[model samples]
Target: MYLTFWGVRGSYPVPGAATVRYGGHTSCVELRSDRGKCLVIDAGTGLRGLGKKLAQEFRKPDGATYNLILSHVHWDHIQGLPFFEPAYIGDTKIVVHAPRAAAKELRQVIGGITRHEFFPVDLDAVPADFEFHEVVPGSAFEIDEFTVLPIGLNHPFGAVGYRVDADGSSMAYVSDTAPFDRMLHKQHFTAGIEEPSDEDREILKTMRANLVESLREVDTVIYDTHFTSEEYEQFPHWGHSTPEHALQICQEAGVRQLVLYHHAPAHDDDMMDRIAEKFGLLGKEANVVVCVAKEKMTLTMGEVTNPGIVA
Candidate 1:
């Protein structure tokens, strides 16, 4: 399988000279199996570009099949679905997989945003055959040649981390999750009205253990590193992680490579360069291949390759 980063920034898109190197588009990644099956990780603004490229390079007379796995319904993660060029093509088939909601169906949760009041085009009006699948957390399923495992993440309204395995290689994508703070998690569940019981601590521990096990020995782990240790101290409940959090997880999981993803919108290219350099040194010491995810960077199973600018 091959992995490509179309958009790396988190929160929102930031286009300017300051963000030119790392890019400004919000969270979207493409994974293509050796058999040519295309699986998209998120539908952020970057999906627009990926859609156009796929249309140009691979669109067939019968259109193409796209599997989109959403981490959550946050705006920055799903905003590009309405603008995805493939949905405009009549013969296209889009399969959207998302975590099951408490009340609404997966389709309703996603289609709610594309309603007439929010966007000019309704979800039903998209010129494609659409299917929505609700994924249960901690469940593993198969899509084409890839085995996908969805793990619940520590985020508001809940999110899921995905581990994809194919052809003896694996990649785990843990986006938009904060470091598991036991007290904060208890507060989240209890609305800050009371202290957590011992049971709460045990539940949190189990969740963390499951996440670590899901990531164990993966070839590449794309982690949410949206803050520095200092910034994380200020926004502990903001549903994002720091580079330190990422390194700890990767080191513990014995991951071969780590890709720092979901960059903070305010972190300019210079800031990112410094962070990457710092982590690069630490990665060397830890015997892990570490790189900050830049837009258009591509990685095959055994090697990291940057095709540079994607035209």
Candidate 2:
């Protein structure tokens, strides 16, 4: 298995000199199985570039097929679908798997974004053959050579995290989730209670256990690290995690490598460099390989086995 980071920044695109090193585009990742099956994790701004490259490189007499696994329908996650150059090609087949409960709703959401008001061409008019699949959270499915397990994440509109395994290698993509803090659920109980009720505690325990199980022994874990601990304290309900939180999870799950991803839009290259250096040291101490996700960075499974940056 091979993985590439096309976009790492979160929230929105930040195109400027300050962000040139890491990336300006929002979330998107490309994964390739040993058998050459192509799977795209998200369709953010970076998808446009991936599409252009695919158009130039991938040629099939019948049609080029792509499997797109969407984490959610947020603008930053699906905004580039209409702009994807390959979607305009007459012989391209794109299968989009989303976390919507119904397939029709998924189609509606994708179609709504490409309506005449927003884009010149409607989604139905797109030249490619589009197939929408609704994926339920907590379900395991297979696409080509990859086995994918989708787990529910703690986001406002709901999100899904994916663990993909192929060729004896496994990778987990855990984006757009907040740390499972007990304080966040205080509203459901009496304010004076010093500790959560037994039921609440059990729920939290199960949540963390499930997440760790999904990532257990994975070769690489690309996790949401959209904030520092200080920043996460201020925005506890923002549905994002901190580098500290990511490190804790990786350590608990015994993951070999952890990629800190979904960078905050305001974090510049210098800030990212500092964060990477700090976490790199922490990872070294904990015996876990750690790196900050950068645009165009590629990692070949089984090639890297130490705690260090890939690029």
Candidate 3:
């Protein structure tokens, strides 16, 4: 199995010279089994490029089924769907697995991406057959050669992190979440310093515990590290995590490697380099390998044994 990062930026796309090295596209990743079965995570701006590649690879008349799992439907996470080329191919089938929203159905949430006012093509008019499945948090489900477990996350409008295990190899994707200590986000946003009730406090504790347990000893963890320690204090309720928060969880989970993902839009390549250096040293001391996720970076697993980067 292998994991490829097509996009790493958070909140929004930030294309420019400064962000060229690390990439400016937001939150898309591709995972493939050793046997070549494929599953995608998120549909951020990076999905446009990935879709183009997939269109060429699966151009046969019989077509192919592509499975995509999403953490949540913030604009940055789902904005690339309208441009996904395979959606224009008649024989292709796209299956999407995502967290169940509080008020909307899975299709309604996704189809909104292509609402006529927002895009030229309506989702219903797309050529490909799209299937939507609402994933229940804490439940395990299978997608082709992999087994996935969805764990609830602390994010606005709610979100869930995914742990994928296949062929004895495992990895987890946990992004767009806060540290779970200060805030308990729900379907709506909170305006001020709202403390959790006793009931909500217990829920937060269990949620954090569940996230750690789900990631236990995973080969790799691609996590949201969108804030610096200083920045986190300013916007604790913004639904993003600092590297420290991610490291703390990975340490408790006994994870082998921690890949810093969901880069803040304000962090350019130089800032990312500094983050990599600082966390690299911190991870070495913690006995976990740390890597910064970059666009086009690939991590091979399973038979590969060592999770080395491939050009």
Which predicted model would earn the best TM-score?
3
Tens digits of lDDT, candidate 1, 109-226 = 8999988889999888888878999988788999999999998887767889999998678999999787764333422443322333777567667777888999999999999999
**Number of clashing pairs, model 3?**
0
Q: Rank the candidates by lDDT, best first.
A: 3, 1, 2
> Please, what is the whole-model Cα lDDT of each candidate in the order they appear?
0.85, 0.85, 0.90
Q: Determine which window of 10 residues in candidate 2 has minimal summed lDDT.
A: 184-193
At residue 276, give the lDDT of candidate 1: 94
Please provide, for model 3 over 73-126, each residue's C-alpha lDDT reduced to its tens digit, 9 standing for 90 to 100.
Answer: 999999999989999998989999999777688899899888888998988899
Per-residue alpha-carbon lDDT of model 2 for 191-229, expressed as tens digits?
A: 231344777567667777798888989999999999999
| Candidate 1 total steric clashes | 0
Model 1 worst lDDT window (10 residues): 302-311
Candidate 2 wrong stretches, greater than 4 Å:
101-104, 182-202, 303-311
Query: How would the candidate models be sorted by TM-score, starting from the highest?
Result: 3, 1, 2
Work out the TM-score per prediction. 0.92, 0.90, 0.96
Estimate the TM-score for candidate 3. Answer: 0.96
User: Backbone collision count in every prediction?
Assistant: 0, 0, 0
